[model samples]
Target: MRTIALHTQTSEQIGLVLENNDVIEYVSTRPEVRTLSGSIYLGKVSHINKAIQAAFIDIGEERTGFLKKESVPWAQTSIEGTLKEGQSITVQVTKEPSGTKGAQLSADITVPGFFVIYQPYGKRTAVSKRVDAEQAEELKTWTSQQLGKDEGVIVRTAASKVSTQTILNEINQLRDLWTRHIKANTTDRSHKLFDDPILPDQLIRKHPLPLIKEIVVNNSKLGQWIKQRYPILAEKVKWVKSVSTYTGISINELQSKLIQPVVVTEQGMELVIERTEAMTVIDINSHKFKQKSLSSYQKLEMNKAAAAEVAKQIQLRNISGIIFVDFISMQEKKQEKDLQKYMSGLVRKDPVSTTILGITRLGLMEITRHRRFSNVSEELSAKQKPTFSKDTLIYRLERYLTENTQSEAVLVAISSDLYNHKKQLLSNSISSKIPQELFVRHDASIIDWQIELEGSLDMIQTVISERVYHVDNLF
Candidate 1:
């Protein structure tokens, strides 16, 4: 069974997709680095690069959006012929802004519903290939009749469970959503038209119902909203005061593991995953395999086991674009073929478009995964590893004082920003974390923060009383 866990933390909202109690995917959203994917915009054509066959558009975002000539579904000519410098057009964001680059936009607009994706400029109606062959053909014919020649609908796997009436209802709702945003011959300035940023609902829509044990969220309002929108989920949607308390999963521990580059498998193999601007690299080392010696077949088995871990890491990290994996070298061509087939089968399980380009001449496995959002590392600021806030430090200090130094209290020297807070606010805020008996003394002498002294409460007080004018006792 699968469970979805949602939590709001210090700087971001986190979502976890757990399969059989293991975290399969980790996603987060931050206010500063928001995603632009699936957002529609009234954009103005800023520049058309005929050489590159692309257009730069001003969509009222921090950076301009890039729309390739091929992305314009309705266009029959070159980008220069199709777009003018001052022309206004409706576009949808297909990718987020990376580094200094702008977001990737597309003219082919698609609005997604639970069971169908409404394509306003799509050429033909279609259904997921995972659907039964006969049913896919039937849905294709039926949906083609429902949608006109210009528009189309891509039926999803979930559509098989619902009645035709429910599918049509979803189709109409998605169509209405597009029709409401797009209008005929309006000269509107460059600005945002619509933002489909409800990630929890989007995730729930993507996963089928039979696999889900329950969708637990910390926020009651969000749980209620999910229940309302997806009545099909029935009692599967639940509201809880604390997700970890109910699910027995520590989100913080999972998040911490996400930031680390090294992953050690139970097979004693380690995967060192590194992300670069150009691509991601995964180097697998089997120096410490539990088996002392391996036969050719045992080597093949090790590579296959590593392949499963690689696939899980790819999804969990949300690593996209080009990826190269350097696995333990296999000497036999037959063994290499077996490993390739095994990895291909594993990548097919990913929801996103992931393809194995087969093994290169250097025995490196080449892979490509395309996605629209920032990766787990980027969202977590794993590279930066910023210092903790004052509140976080206080919480840590309280834990330390309670756990290890129960009889002893410490004198801390913190920066003025932390030490010189408003009088009443400091007492109320800092005092609430520790017991009234445990004491804290602060001074603005140090550059950042440091623990000055630790002793029994009375000894610390005696020292402070000797140097009475030097420090301020916060509690």
Candidate 2:
């Protein structure tokens, strides 16, 4: 279940609902915050960089509007041909600017809300894929009859169960707003016609708090705004007098907890997930599990549970791209199949879609997920706590070697700045166990070492043969 909560001021007070995840609640009375999602903009082009195939437009903010060549209108090919310095252009803000990047803009405009996307220049009305074919035809017929010649609405996923009048009303409202904007900007080439609403207004419009369980707010102005816009949310709002009260702890105490270790446990095993620029890597440790005491079936079951948990964590953290899961090897084919089935089931619960490629012979699972925004680590981590970590580097190397193996066995270990820590440890642990005559190589560029053994060309073939997986673990 997904629930959304809205908080006012600076303190994060959003709560997640346990039953249905789609609903979010926030406290804000500002009308600007309520409907800023589909607002269009008439901006002034500040600069164009033909070399980078990008342009920066002034949108009346601290940051500028970003327009890439690919985002330009289909009729416009080259930035040099389409745009000029100080020229005014109509652009739609796709995403808010963060960090060094400016707000993302597109020449193609789309006005999106809960139920529909209104395209000013579109020629067709389309239904959402989630809508059933029969229902879609009925809605289409109704919409066409009501809209007549107006053919710019694209029904969204939220329109599946909505009333026709509600969709039409929203479209008309958006169209009226756009008309006013165009009229206001027609003669004014030097001024910015549209600017994103302030943060408070944006929060109200884009973040729906009704679906959320609770909201915490620190700023009195914002709290009042919430009460004015959404009286229903007022009861659920909690006011935080100060930042300290908002965090539920003193600054010093919270700082102390930042450096504390995070311990995760499951089925007598422990694991840790570390962040990196390329991808997040999770390390599995048997920990207290006595060797040979647990059957292969039991061990595989435990690993499947662990994998499911990790998948949930990834979704919670909004991690994306390549994810590699290392599981304890099970020689039995049924055990491997069961583990794969369980893991896939767990992953299906995620709101975002994921693809689970089955385990390799080396006991590694390859997974990929779509990313709509930055992951949690990227959003929250500071400069001092850079995204890279020793654990992540080792796991990535292990995953890479396992997937990219050729004719040789690859052994990898991390390198240390002081006295060869990971290198010495890996060499000591596996050097005597494997063939001594194998080719060895040390990569000091990053934190890991790479060791390739001879006569393993057949290994890659075997690993590829065992692929059988799908994402259904969450069920």
Candidate number achieving the greatest TM-score relative to the actual structure: 1
Extract clashing residue pairs from model 1: none
- Give candidate 1's error at residue 220 in angstroms: 2.5
Counted clashes in each candidate structure:
0, 33
lDDT of each: 0.79, 0.57
User: TM-score of every model?
Assistant: 0.72, 0.58
Q: How far in Å is the alpha carbon of 240 misplaced in model 2?
A: 9.8
Off by over 4 Å in 1: 44-57, 63-70, 76-88, 98-102, 160-162, 180-189, 228-231, 381-475
Prediction RMSDs, each to the true structure: 12.3, 16.4
